[model samples]
Target chain A: MLILHCPHCDRMVDETDLHPGGEAHLKRHGPEADAEAFENYLFMRENPKGVHFERWRHVYGCGKWFLAARNTATLEVYGTYPAQTHQPPQTIRDTITERQPGWAWGDFR
Target chain B: MSEPVSALRGRATSGSVQVSDMGLQGMISLRCDLSFGKLKALSKDLVGAPVPALREAQVRNDRAALWMSPDELLFLMPHTEVDDALSRIAKAMKDQHHLALDVSDARALLRVEGPFAREVIAKLAPVDLHPDVFGPGQVLRTRLGQIAAAFWMTDAQTFQVICFRSVAHYAFDLLEASAKAGPVGHFPRGT
Candidate 1:
């Protein structure tokens, strides 16, 4: 069982007590965007083999949604932060960079 | 507008632990930023206590306030006082971005007591029930079986559980079953 620290409740929550909300940081394309852009926004998702950012809900605890940076291969969680953040905080990025050197995703390097 | 009745009709069961319906309890769901000065002031008047810190519960006399989330609190009192409490909250929080409502009838309250009360709760919830981990002043919102529930220790050997009224029977059955299964001897007797 994967245990993750929920930033909202500040508790190490069990995986069974949380709900996975797929990928995080999906930029939505409004109606003004082209078909391809909207399609990418709706369907395209990152399934990286290494570090991944995902959304999770502490459904059984504080009932707040938060983001997590995790290593898909090793199941190592780098950090968790509130969903209100636009992107992972610098601390989490630094932690990930230290562990997985030369890691880059989208516009973030 | 009719008489208020508990979901379990005040039924109780005895096994290794005592499980009983706590009857109608006045509960108000107040959702607002906890840092708001007005909320701190209104809560003092509304519940006779300050807003509890995160995951904490403060009980004084017959009134109590428990933190449900960072921005939500549940206030408890006598069943007959729900309307008055809601009105007071409404009047105090007008022109503010807040949500306060009478949720007493929407949920069921159960009490679990006995030497093995902590074990019974541990069998279902994912939370740590050790005295050092979850003592008197802490409250947790978690799942009991397949239903959503919240629980807190009234003391070392007594626990109060809250779940939706619609599933009161299920919750009672779950608690009864857990109690009937007997203590696992996982937790030592006495603190």
Candidate 2:
């Protein structure tokens, strides 16, 4: 039931209007990578209770994919940005830090 | 060389509003960076209207340019003018990275007219249809019940909805049902 802003369309859209695309910012393991690395890349996921980053498609709106940073525990959406971005913008990380203090996710702080 | 027929063959429905198939309309799917300088000029030359701003439509008389996405626009004109429009676009943007195609036959256009037009569409799409929030010149690509559709206001009391021709009958029936479902009074009648 979350109403999230779509960075591409600049519209606040209903959750029903969006399609969740699982976790974001996963590193890829190519054909040369070890079995363990490939398995982790394919199936391993972080289930952090706070400050989760995920992909979402504006399936009903602009039909573009975007990334969202939100607090899973409180349903507070920190921000959303275009899918082309490799990392959450500095401002969103700063916002998360201001609330959670010293919080970091994988390689992003 | 052969006769072109619209989906549903120009069906019309009456309830609180007038819903009818707008018949075959010429639509061109143009995908390119909107900021390309020549795009604005060439589109104006082809459609008699400037390329629309985000979520807006640039329209003049029987022609309109509707913003479909960050890098896409759907141009509308008379059905007979499609081939010429495609050629003009090809010639104008030949040197640029662009994709232009005639989509006139791939979709159906429906018109809903009456004071309750907004409410009728609102009953289906998740868009906020308040007059101030959505009115003439604003185009929205959104879901209509179970289908993907785009719609825009031609005037305060008129709306034009475009959906895939494969779903034309379903879209028309949805609009008709919404129109007959009786107003929820979410928006005042005749506003």
- Each candidate's interface RMSD, rounded to one decimal? 0.9, 1.1
The sequence of per-residue lDDT tens digits that candidate 1 reaches over residues B77-189 is 99988888888888878878899988999999999998898888899988777777887778889899998999887788888999999999999999999999989888875
Q: Candidate 1: misplaced stretches above 4 Å?
A: none
Note the residue pairs that clash in candidate 2: none
The global C-alpha lDDT for each of the candidates, from Candidate 1 onward, is: 0.89, 0.90
Per-residue lDDT of model 2, residues B1-191, tens digit only: 88999997989987669899999899999999889889988888878887899899877778899999998999999999999989899988988999999999999999999888889999999878888788888898888999989999888888999999999999999999999886788887775
TM-score of chain A of 1: 0.96
Give the TM-score of each candidate: 0.96, 0.96
True contacts kept of each: 0.73, 0.57
lDDT of 2 by residue, A12-84 (tens): 8888889999998988898899999999999989889888999999987778999999999999999999999
Q: After aligning candidate 1 to the native by TM-score, how far in Å is the CA of B139 from where it should be?
A: 0.6
lDDT of candidate 2 at residue A35, scale 0 to 100: 99
Give candidate 1's whole-model lDDT.
Answer: 0.89
